[model samples]
Target: MARNIAFGRIQEDMNKTSFFKILADEDLSSESMRLIPNEFWRSSECKILPPKVTLKVAWGSSWPVNLSPFMGCYLMERKGWEEFLNDNHLGDNEFLTFTNEGNNCITVDIFQKNCVEILKPLNTSSSNVKNEEMSCVDPVIAESNKRKVDSNVYGASSSSSSAATFSLTIKKSHLTLLSIPVTFAKEHMPKVRTKFVIHDPKGKPWEVVYVPSNGSKLFSSGWRFLANGYGLAVGDLCTFRLVRPKEMVLEVLHDSP
Candidate 1:
């Protein structure tokens, strides 16, 4: 399926408005989130508001979030939501307030228990990468790292002939989790949340959790281990070939095509 991913062109800006989101399990697990519908932008007709907006935080970092039209509202698409969630280590019950501080920037203030704002980034990534990689990484192409490749590298084309395969251009924002394309999810992914094995290019199996909700799928809950083990970084093009119903082979190319 040709996914129409032209997010609000990714350049849309927001009108002056404010909204809040209380993180829920489904929202956390899925690839997108819906902003509460309000008077300003209740639909695409409300183009005066941004379909895509920049998310700014207290710490001064900014991320671009794509908002897709949904039932009378906009959905915070997966493009930037994953990185935002992972970078912030957002958990259930957390409260997030998005205030449009002019210039199409949506300022994010994250809060937790009793509505106290969280100010620091929660560091949960493993520090010992070599040890972690050695535990579950397959013997990959040792020489691929030394070369500077382009950004379009792929193990398989998005126009893949096989229903069991897909390719992704990864970035730093997606290291903690990866969203399975909706078309792929609906056809190949398990409907119920399940555990699956993602084997590195060299055949080392990394067990990760599959979360499915609202017709979306994501590899979460242990994905970081796989990313760390594979040594996948921003700009790395990775191909996922499903060799078995519950398993896949992950091929990583450090450079672009």
Candidate 2:
């Protein structure tokens, strides 16, 4: 599968400025949007890459994606990548270009299906933006709304919010599904399998289901979304603070790899 891959040279050919990737279904299901060419992996410089990298669009938008070595290739993690894909509505078979801008930053140029021509997504007045609107939210507006939520709700937290904060050191299992201390859950969580909103530090809301099983409490389904967004790893610390009857705020402190 590695041989005859659909990607450009990493650091040698074409002046070593850029590489291209045609998206695939496995990338979506596995939460690895982009893979570095094998040439990059074999390069001496690849040994010193940072744990994270910044992905930039021509527009004034950027995402911080975690970089990990996988299956002899480097892959962009779920944190910044999935959000970028969802926000931009990028689909399978879409073409992408990664241009190294130095200092762990890569400028991404997106191409429409079956074409090498780049699309000017930031040109809102252009037809391209109109067409994109038919599939997903405008990337610019979605990002603005995200910031709005952060500013608005974050400032609204009161002393009452701190009254209910709880902290836990993350374990390997927490990456799969977070477990709430039994004592805290029994005292606060609804007895039934109920849906409640969880606000990340950015104030983005995740509606997670709280399940009680044999005196244990677990956050399921939606919790993974939040975990992935923040790139939670084992040994990280998480603190959750109840802000309202149906809402709580979460803070994640990642451990050094």
Candidate 3:
């Protein structure tokens, strides 16, 4: 069944502004935050905000076990909720807390008006799912689909879209490879080299090398990828891919092993 992600509700007045785009604040908006329509929360926009509780750091696994502080926050939609609770509740500072009792912390931020939602089971569950997805190849494909690949290899006012096709190829039981196209310069250009670093779901690192080349080798040296896209960098993760293949081909493959 298709799932409908409802963001909750937004005041009618704020709903008309197109300035609101739901995304991680760090990636898209330099501004810490901006007001969003309550409907944005109802339509999957809720994820854009910080969780009410989060684990900043932790250690050990047992009793007296070294654990980080647990952080917490109280959320409010508007002045009314604050009046009811008798606290200065504004969706202003992105609040975060630490606890001596546990290995996690809490963060609280409001999503919309009149609603005080806690990101408990939902936050934990989603983090688990994201971790699992990151470990596998799924996230990479999703990233590629969502982000356009462009590079400034050529001296143009704008970057051109990569024309090469990308696909997953697995050889050994534990190895994965990503095939992508690379374009070469028309005139006698100096051979160059670049590198691509793939990151796993846990933010682990994997690196691959690509070398620039010309002639038949350029076409044959499809850049090899060692892992699926899930473990690789996405649109906002890193700035560029660097590699130079032995043969001059306008393509690079990311290989996983």
Candidate 4:
């Protein structure tokens, strides 16, 4: 009699996003660091990225980080990385957190010893100012001045908010069913299957079923027909915005020079 060997199925974790903390090596601190492999870029968990993604590194504000392919791997260039390290006064053994911020951007938070939080005042008092002059100022004028100061402090713009925008890159496997972020699905999707109306870049409306994740609830589904109708391919970037729970707007960004 011959014995048979059985292999167990490989299970994938769908809830986890690409996250890592790296110590400041000579190259990473002074030069560039290699990005995760192509498989990671193409993985269902990482479909929210483009082949040539724009990484906006943010500490207090955001700055564009250069990325290019070298030796079969992407490299976060030295120019911006060096400036970021030097500006933050990072040294050896300092820990840096790299997290995806959606829309092809990443946030880099620096952690070092002896860090302290300091609150800075937005405005300073002027001793030369007279109480009589302040008292005479109109209430409406004072409110307008405060609004201007607040806008300047927070960098507020007149443009629409981008909070509702969602980005994803197409994969070969996505043609069957698109994988959605676990947290997003839990908060936005219905418990049972539902229909969603999505508008494409050309403003064409599409109706598709939205199926919430089952079991561990790692991912959500229902985009096969939409992906096929749009002729999405691997490496193509798609952006979506939820106009309502059952309605959404979509935009496809083509690769440019």
Using all chains and alpha carbons, the TM-scores for the candidates as numbered come to 0.37, 0.39, 0.19, 0.35
Which of the predicted structures, 1 or 2, would earn the higher lDDT when compared with the native?
2
| Candidate 1: C-alpha RMSD after superposition | 19.7
Candidate 2: TM-score? 0.39
lDDT of 1 by residue, 152-186 (tens): 22223312343366888997767988988888777
lDDT scores of the candidates, listed in order: 0.58, 0.60, 0.25, 0.46
Off by over 4 Å in 1: 1-163
- Evaluated against the true structure, the overall lDDT of model 4 is 0.46
In candidate 1, position 113 carries an lDDT of: 52
Query: How many backbone collisions does model 1 have?
Result: 8
* Per-residue lDDT over 93-155 for candidate 4, one digit per residue giving the tens place of the 0 to 100 score: 554445443445553434343321111121224232111212222332222222212211111
Candidate 3: tens digits of C-alpha lDDT, residues 17-113: 1122222344222222322233323322234443322221111101111211123222222332222112222233222221211112211222223
Q: Where's the lowest-lDDT run of ten residues in candidate 4?
A: 1-10
Better of 2 and 4 by lDDT: 2
Ranking by TM-score: 2, 1, 4, 3
Q: After superposition, how far is residue 146 of candidate 4 from its true place, in Å?
A: 23
